[model samples]
Target: MAQSYATDLLHLIQGPPGTGKTLMLAHLAQLLAQDGLRVFVTALTHRAIHNALNKIPQVDANLPVCKIGEERLTGDLNVPNFETFDQSHFAEKSGGDVVGATPFALQSQRLANVEFDVVLFDEVSQITLPLAIMGMLAGSKYIFIGDENQLPPVTTFSETEAAQTSIFAYLAGRGQETMLNITYRLNDVLTDWPSRTFYKGELKASDEAASRRLNLSPEATRWDFVLDPDSPAVFLDLCHTNTTVRSRIEAEVVSELVLSLLMRDVAPQEIGVVVPYRAQSRLIRSLLRRILMDDEVNKKLVVDTVERMQGQEREVILVSFATASQKFAAQMADFLFQPQRLNVAVTRPRSKLILVGSHHMLKADEIVPEHKETMDMLRDLDRQLPDHHPAQRGYQRVKATRKQIANYYRLLISIMLK
Candidate 1:
């Protein structure tokens, strides 16, 4: 629409959260689809891009962009992470053509001679350096679309220090991005909450990278931040064992909870649950089935991974943080510091956020780092949840034996045994 015509080589779109970034990407992808381009579009998580693409009639009717990732979705071939993408198979299938993939996943499949007229990366901020560069290198017409204001690159301990050394550098070498100014969501005052208090918004307020971002007005005075006052919080306390629970097992939990809370005011469809990882994809599928039983429930509750739901709004979201700390839970577990992940969890729920934790641990940012500060703050914060939360909880001490009994008998029996 800008008549800016994205170069087949590389185009980067940077904007605020509510901007139609994903929509624009899908529109371009639809054009590519109509042209009979073997366009393969993918997101960092199955939940993020797949649904948006699947919703488009072009995708649903014609060239459905297959989701090729760790969790195999529709039209996707069974591929693991970047660790095992077969370059030969990619070349053979793609024929030096178009495919969309997560930056890392594209790298894993180190596709040789694979080319595209238009290659797009939606939500590029979530992409790390190595993966982004790899994908950019493979495609002649590369489009990297993401709001740097929303989330930065999520780097693991494995990645190098310099962000520029990675894919972003390659794009910058190409020179200048065409910015999208309008926001699709946040019509009037609702814009302010996300604009000012949102991730980059807060950063901007502090005068750090403030000039780069567009500021929005605040809504506290104009609109009630809480939409529904009478709406009681729907708390679905998920056990940590939720990840490992068989899909059928998880489905049963959803079913029981729905019936148990049926008399309550909230509709089954309104209830949303967000699991920890892609590993819980099966569990979500099962739970979704249970929630949809009422046919009247139009808007599906069972959802995709956390990354997809980032900055998204839902009626009520049950969150399983997916144990941040593997060992014993501590301050870092609270996830207060890591605003990206926290933002994903917090914003999903419209009225309430039902958080189920293995341990009520605090995120590092939740606690004071310095000795004197820790000594002073721990007096207040440490008192909230206990030190020996494991032992005090009683489940940790007996979980092994309890699980064994559950396997022998139905877990319902194991609950009675407990």
Candidate 2:
């Protein structure tokens, strides 16, 4: 289908989590460039642009890709930086078979006279309609690749309104998309709920991904319950004392958990700690720095907010919800319980995902009014069946609202940890 529609003016590919979207885009760009088309690649962020461009060489070692960005911002990508070349020098010396930049950067004088035959937009879900238009103008043909189920572009306005809808979502609503069905990152256990809830059960793990497990030896750790490789998803109900933006107890547990993973021979880079608030990220990072002591080891461990964790994956992802206060959770429900944020957080782990938070607080009754419908649906699903085991109740809720509950992450966690 992709080949048949390769020349379409607007092409959309809905790539769910861990589905090798970047690699697919890279290969497509390579094929287009090989066919003598001038291909331009872009995204909302420099990291995303570099991620897509870095893979082009994997397909062909000698592919000449020009990266347009400040030298410092374009991390170790093997491509030549456009900044180092004068306008005439670039046009003359480099044929510009493939060029990469952010939509904002494409407006630079360096690219004023440049045009592309094809424009590949990576992470298009994070590109607003206006930005998407800017990118579309860069070329005659376009390929948009991203997951609408993940984070949209960050905006100060209310995201619920149609004004802020991303181009990917806008086009996807019109049925102009081809869904990528298989994920290469998550295991079957890790993939289950996200597949059912977000993709209408169409998303699935590839054979290798379905059978993959963490490399850690379960017998090597005393906290095997938390470290069990066989259990891909573990929710640690750390019902700690009240807190607002940051929880010291949660930070302590995260530090200890990192220590255990390190003892089990997990590389520092293989682990990531994601938090909702900057304060919590700082607290966890400080604790990790203190425990690891070595600056080199501490630098490798990524402790960041969900916004920064997009387009990244790790062997083990530890998410700290950091607030145990129901009042605070309710007050921040619009941000905390947003389905896109939760989906990005949980899907970052390739082997295991450990979520630590106060399940009771997350299940607070005083939710944002927008999410009230999701909770009501969960209740309706609960009443449709006779009393049963806790797991069965959770399964029923998941089945009932698989497609409608956009904000069901909070209630889903509550049901799972019950």
Candidate 3:
């Protein structure tokens, strides 16, 4: 990896999700610094840039790194960007080991004289070609780290203003890219459908043996939140509503399952709630708040749209696919049809994944022909239902173990009596 600097003028690292791209970036920066080269690491957003910077050790300890742009949302790191800092403050450490910033920050007049030996771009697919070109001008050589299959640059408004392909995508087509082969996030069972459907069966799990089967813990294996202990990926076939109001049934079921996990000694922070739309996230959050009164529990229970859940992971993930009804399928299809969105949602769970939505909507040809991959993946999950689970053609059972069953009814009875 360190030899990338001497190998090519422009190198592309095309890695799939959970392929340790960020960790690779950090190590590359360290190697470049060790070789006495000036390096700059960048991404499109402040959060992304900050994340890359956070991977490096303290500047004083090893590399002298500066972060530029808006203050980080978390304020976890106090390092200011070159453009934000006083000219003299940056000048002191200006020629130091490495720097992290957004492309816009690199264009600043303050950094015009600050040349870099190598520029590393994280999430390069999110960067447009023009911005990438401008950033490249500051360095003699460059490296791009991104997964085009996961999410492409957001260029809805600049359809005609800018070319659709990212710089990474453009270079990759010419065969100037290296693929990161190992994936640390998913086991083989969870990765099978995505591999064949998205990457044409090219994606490989880091653990060949573990990838061969779903490795649920003893508690999770017996946890009947859904049927089939061997199935890490599941589809909970709920009725999708056409109204603007959220699906109450989905919300109730999510609540019950989340509570069940909590009752079973699962940490709240290890669980996540993924929904297709912002409206559904809001409704689910509200429902969770009412049931989980503790602020800590509410804070740890992440209920958000899939876009927001990207670059994040949890031990357990519950996805809410609220798109149902033929009339609403058009609107819902707009949000759910994209293969990238589904990829992001499905891959975020490390241990277990549960998808809740109407199976009819998932398999409907009338919804959107372009979304066949998304539909196919959903159907593959639905096919995992065993005969013993028992449901209609389109409806799959959400199973729970004996203990969960006992606690569920016990809680229900207590509430009724109260």
Every model's TM-score: 0.51, 0.86, 0.84
Off by over 4 Å in 3: 58-61, 72-90, 93-96, 109-112, 157-163, 208-223, 227-229, 243-245, 367-374, 384-418
Off by over 4 Å in 2: 84-90, 93-96, 162-164, 367-369, 373-418
Candidate 1 clashes: the total is 9
Tens-digit lDDT string for candidate 2 (151-265): 8888886647533478887888655678889999998767876886678989999999877788984445435557767566666666664787899867877777787798888
lDDT of 2: 0.75
Residues 1-418 of candidate 3: C-alpha lDDT, one tens digit per residue: 7446566697888878778888888888887887778888887776677777777774235676777555434365545454453442645553447777667766675465667889999888678888898889889888899877676677654322333567766777766678886678876566666676777788877774233332334564223647333566677765454533357667767777787677666688988998877888888888677777679998988888876777788877898776666556554654565667778888887767888766556545555576565566656656754452233222244533445546655764564455
For lDDT, the strongest prediction is 2
**Candidate 1 lDDT score at position 301:** 50
Please write out the lDDT profile of model 1 over residues 1-418, one tens digit for every residue: 2422345455677645445566677677766656656554544555555545544443335443344454434332322223233422443453222344555555454433345555677666666666665665655566677655344555553222433333443464356576665554332222323444443343111222211211222322111111122211222223343222123444444343333333344555665666545656566555445444545552455555665567465545555444434232333332222434544454444343344443323333334443233223322322323232322210011111344325423533433444
Instruction: Report residue 191 deviation for candidate 3 (angstroms).
Output: 1.5
- Model 3 — which ten-residue stretch has the worst lDDT? 388-397
Stronger candidate by lDDT (2 vs 3)? 2
